[model samples]
Target: MERTVGMSRPELIQVADTVARDKGIDREEVFDAMEQAIQKAGRSKYGYEHDIRARIDRKSGEIRLARYLEVVDEVEDELTQVTVAQARRKNPEAEVGDYLVDPLPPIDFGRIAAQTAKQVIVQKVRDAERERQYNEFRDRLGEIANGLVKRVEFGNVIVDLGRAEALLRRDEVIPREAFRVGDRVRAYIADVRQETRGPQIFLSRTHEQFMARLFAQEVPEIYDGIIEIKGVARDPGSRAKMAVFSNDHAIDPVGACVGMRGSRVQAVVAELQGEKIDIIQWSQDPATFVVNALAPAEVTKVILDEEKHRMEIVVPDDQLSLAIGRRGQNVRLAYKLTGWDIDILTEATESERRQEEVRARTRAFIEALDVDDVIAHLLVTEGFYDVEDVAFVDLAELTQIEGFDDDVAAELQNRARSFVEERNARDESRRVALGVSDDLARVSGLGGASLVALGERGVLTLDDLGDLASDELCEIVPSLSESEASEIIMAARAHWFDGEDTAGDSDAGNDDAQTGSDDAGDSRTDD
Candidate 1:
């Protein structure tokens, strides 16, 4: 005996409502999925060649099935198209473009057909649920999410975020942090991606922003925008540093982040598995910020090279290891936080280096200018390091030194200029001997010494120099800074574009040559 069970229309509507509510999707979408399932079963019961459609009444829950045929001048597809004459036999007002809908009889669904319909409905619902999950979490990136640990797969954690599943990769978790099923966990929503398998939500507990977000949750001032987090550098579960600033002058930013007796910062530390945090007040000055960033260690002096954005910090002999931290972690974090390369030294080392630099400058001055030790020491003490400085600087500056008169200044200037001229001639002859072209020598910001250096490194022509990157050129000539090397390379490559400019007349070429000559003169004077 064949068993046939009837489902009432209202019960169908109730099932759709229940599914939509439970799956957090729209009821209309569930109804459309149900209609598609029923239409598929109808096609199975009848011939697959018929044009069948199904709809459920929103108010009355009535099921309506129909076969639609298009009225055409002549029928091409016999099952889906009918002739106008044949269509008009059913209704006198039938036209060529109108659709003639024929009411379909109720389908007595078989067991196989019912099983197939259930599968369709289930798949459609699953698709809608995934879409909902993706859209819900995509906008929630860079936020803290609370979830339960669903399982562990090869050291990676799968988190259940109530409505969706997220992945916490093994590398993203704090080192040695373990999770078991049913454990409550919190993580930062690092990213969300839609893939063929499903929407993947990636979480991270080791990100620096995770600590920042945790602080924001625990500190009301941070959440209200009164205290701003400028930067954060982390060593995962071991240590971290945060730079914060205050918008209001009266309120201390570091104190606010630390809360009363270290409450706020302690909360964040607990969440990060006891990762020690150093909360430093941010400063607009790089030197001050770096000094504060390296805490628990006293700094004796600081030397900053503003052009290179590098700092050399000198500490007392006893404070060396403390300032450097264990294995240089303290200074490394300070470098990252301040965005500057840093070198740490003790007071004794710095003093010895300073004396050696003075001796070197004095000896260079004596050799280059043929001056006695007394005059060379006077020049070095007056802040003159190179013969070029003595040759090109204002005569008054040289005369201002003690025991120096106008005659002495003039003679020194003559000797410095003569030495520089002789050195330039020697370098030019060396460059020519190495087979370097005159075109490369004429590039702005490249002196005779730089040209000889380039030739020694096998850069012999304008095209050869133009093909080099800025750092590569810097390596070839260590005297040239990165920016200067870049400018010289760009100048060498200017000829490449001259062919493309229709308006590049002879006068334009002359102007370019004149500009290069003027820049070359400036470089010589500066040197």
Candidate 2:
């Protein structure tokens, strides 16, 4: 026997209400979807060319199906438009551009038509559900989402979050952590994408922010704004580092994060599958902050290269392995945490390097100051790193050194000053000989030595300097930063615009003079 379904208005309303409730969508939306589906079936039965529309009464649950023919001054599509004269015959008052609805009898859906209507309703409901899921989860990004494991496919876990499903890619899950169906899992809402199929909610357990969030949850001070996490770096399932600060000094930010008897930090570590966390006290000074970030490994000395954002940490020989950790994980996390490139060295190694630098400086002094090894070594020991330092330093400073009186100090200072002056005069003359312009020498960051270096490299003119990029200038002058080079280049290019403005003013002045002469001639002619 052929299957038959209820066709009454009440029956249709009940079906819509039940579907709306089951699908968690608005009843009106469900009704609208049903009307569209009914209209599709009606057109298939009546005539494909006719403009069929359907509406369901919200309160009475009456289904009204109509075929609308548009009254137009010109009829091009005969199925949808009718001449104004023909339309007036039906209502006697119908004007052009009016729609006349012709009611059709109820549509008794055949097998093919019923299937098509069913597909349409299901598709509409599915689209509505997807939209709802996307809207709900988009605002929840960066928050912790708790859900049950729905399924596992090809190493990726699908989480059932009640209202929607989320994906936990295999790489996002912490190493060695696995989930089975029905397992209660918690992860960070890493992303939510509105794809064509549906909303894709990506969850992650290994993200660095996930650990930071866990700390915020476990430490009430962090959540209450008393403590702030400045930065976090993590090797998921192995180790992590966090730099935190506090506005209140008495609060002891690191202690607060550690909690009473290590309770607070332990809570976060437990959540992270026993990953070790080093809670560092953040400092405004990058050198201090870097030292703290590499804690538990005594830092003998820290040499900062602020321009490059790099630092060198000297530690004892035995502490090297601990400072580096297994496979360099500790230093790696510290580098990420402090945002600095770090070079770790042993104290013995640092001392050897220092000796080598001292010897090299002593040799340079001997060559430049025309002094013996003893005098050059003494100069190096007195903290004179270069001939410039010796030439510019106070004569009193040299006299204070042992075996040096006022006369000896005066003689040494004079020799240093003469050497520097001669070297400068020679270099300046060479720069002039190379055709280096005075404008090129006037660049703020370029010293005489740097200008000479540029001259040596065939960059002798203002135009040559302006055309050189920061990196290219750095090749000529190694100490030049990109910003410094940019300023010099812009200064060189300033003349280009100044010349244009100067010429424009001259032209304008000439035009005014010519016009004034013409007016004077006209006045004389009138006289």
Candidate 3:
């Protein structure tokens, strides 16, 4: 009966409102879904072959159903199209490719039809809700949020964030931390992934950024943008370090973050289950910052190996254990905080190593520069480690050293230069005997030294040079960059294919001398 369509018009709008509010989606979207469901149902009853359409009035909740047919010159699909000649009976001025709509009477739904319609509507609404949730939470990444622990399955805690469920995985939570139902939770929005099932809102309590955000919330100076958190490293519920900087010189960043009597840090520690926090002042100098990062331990000296991004921290023997912490946690966190590899040593160890390095440099200078032990020791103490430094330094810098006159400085420099010249000549003579190409030295990137070095490695031809990689070239000659090596290699490879046709022709000539014009095995068989 027609009453079945109109019986619950008010209930239809009410259900739309309820679903929109519950799903946190737009109301019009739900109405659009309902119309699509009704349209699908209409197609089932009217005939699946027909183009059935349905629409509900948003204001009055009135439903309209129609069967659409396009006027065509030829009847291709009879169920969806009507011939122009046949359409003239319904409308006198009908044209081809025009949709001819026919009003259809509403039909009562069977139980199966109603169930299918419900399923379609529910599926469409669910898809829309997922899209809405993804759009809502995608921009909330890197933000802190609060929710209620809805439940815990296995080890993953599902937090109900009012409108959506966020996942706090076991590994993302601080170690040994647990939660139960109905407990309040706070976490950083580490990631928000829109998956096929739904939007997975991943939360994290152990992330370094989480600690940074907590400081921003607890410290007003950080929130007001007066102080900035430069970096943070966490051992997660055990220990952590936060580096802060103050734009205002008057306000100390460390004092501001620590608050009065460590109130701010204590609050963050309480949240993290008593994780000891060291709020260190960030410095522009890496050595200074490393010293600050390794706090509560007196640093006697810091030796930096900048090329390797490593540091040697010399502490008092008694403070060595304190600086390293229990199970090397302190030094490990310092490495993370400063982005440097660190080695902690006592002053006694550093002194022994320093003496050994001095002895080694003295021996190297005595052998290379042909100087006496006292002069070699003097050069080493004056920071001249290699023969190249002695040869290349300013003549005045060498003369300025104690117990060295202009004649001595001149003699040392001349010997240094002569020693290098003799070495290079010897390397060059070996290179010439090795049959290394003179054209290799002609390449601008390959200097005399690099060419001789390559010759020593038995790289003799352009083809061999081209076949070599950039890193191989660098390993042979340490001064060349990869780009410079690549340029020279590509230049060497330029003539590789140039002589290909001639070489192939020569091979063909050799084949002409064969017993037969065939492959090697066939030629042998003919012979």
Candidate 4:
């Protein structure tokens, strides 16, 4: 049995009021939706194409519709057009193109039409609410906001951003940190998106701007407009390099950022999982700025290689290690801060100062390789002065040596092969003995012989290299490129060792073989 649920006109008004309240829509908007739905449904059901007008009484809650007609001298259509004479009978001043809204008797709306009207109004209300929310949030871009963590699924965080939801993906969050439901967090409004699923708000904590924000929070100088952050670069969770400048000459940007005993920087570092922060003084000159960026190491000079987009920094022999940092961290940070590829060198390589000393030392080392005296001298002059250095060199590079054809290069390598091998073994052993712990072998442009020579010359440590002027080293070894000297010297200092005897038994065997061969040759001639 079908149940009879009868609702009067007043009851329908109360239902509409309840829906408006529940959907957070204004009463007027609800009324408009209902009126439009009702007229459209009724007209479609009755198959009327001519102008149909509808109205709802504000106080009485009564609904009305009528066919509209315009009184015209020339009738364009029979249904909607009426002659002036006929219209004059209804109204005395009825003239051409005047519309007449005549009320028709109430027509019972069918059940299907009523159902269609209700559905359309409800859908319209929802669509309006979505549009209102989208417009409200769209104007909020670039602002910081607080959100509650709703759920974390598949490394993607869903946040309840008050009126709507936003996504805080894994990449946006700092590593190893998590948010639980109900946790209120602050993030920058990285992006706002509109789609079928409504507006998408993207939040980020790892953004470079995030670091800038943290600094702005801690530094009073920055807050008070005395200082401004020039730029920031981050390897997030590892280290960050920031360039800051002060408008007022009285304020030292680095000191202001460091705060007494590092209080200011420590706060930012704590939020970033103990990540190291380097606050550099910003300079208008790119060269000076880069030198500052590669801090804790003295730079002898900077040569900008514009074509390669790299800066070659020449440091003192001792400063090379510090300038390059452990595992190239210093140079890497410098690059990040300055937006340039960095190649570090010692001052000796840049200037023509240490030529005699490096050549004298290089000759001693290269002659031990069993190569021709001229080649040994050439190797030293060209900065390939050690056996291991020549071994590390590619065949193509060795061919670059004057008077060295492919065959001569091959012969040179063959003759000096044992020396190179022994030298490498000794270097490794020395590295272990002296506790030289760098991955310098990975650097393509540096020579192991030059590094060993640096070590032998008492430039045995990164601290030592970091202290020497890059120009001094460049001058000492005029044949070696400034970049090549810097690389080896820097590597040596980072992985320095002393009291290493890598040259022990290996050198003994080589000397013994040479003596025995001479003895054998003399014996054969006598027989």
Superposed on all Cα atoms, the candidates' RMSDs to the truth, in angstroms, are 9.9, 6.3, 7.3, 22.8
**Taking the tens digit of each residue's C-alpha lDDT, what string does model 1 give over 100-146?**
88877667779999999899999889889989989999999999999
lDDT tens digits by residue: candidate 3, 2-41:
2223323667788888999988888999998898888888
Model 2 per-residue lDDT tens digits across residues 453-497: 988899988889879887898788887777777888899889889
List the candidates' TM-scores in order: 0.90, 0.80, 0.82, 0.55
Model 1 segments beyond 4 Å from truth?
Answer: 1-8, 71-75, 83-98, 497-527
Against the true structure, whose lDDT is highest? 1
Which ten contiguous residues of candidate 1 have the minimum total lDDT? 1-10
- In angstroms, the error of model 1 at 442 is 1.1
Between candidates 2 and 4, the one scoring higher on lDDT is: 2
RMSD (Cα, Å) of model 2: 6.3
TM-score of 1: 0.90
Clash count for candidate 4 is 38
Better model by TM-score: candidate 1 vs candidate 2: 1
lDDT of each: 0.90, 0.89, 0.88, 0.75
Whole-model alpha-carbon lDDT for candidate 2: 0.89
Q: How do the candidates rank by lDDT, highest first?
A: 1, 2, 3, 4
Report residue 336 deviation for candidate 1 (angstroms). Answer: 2.2
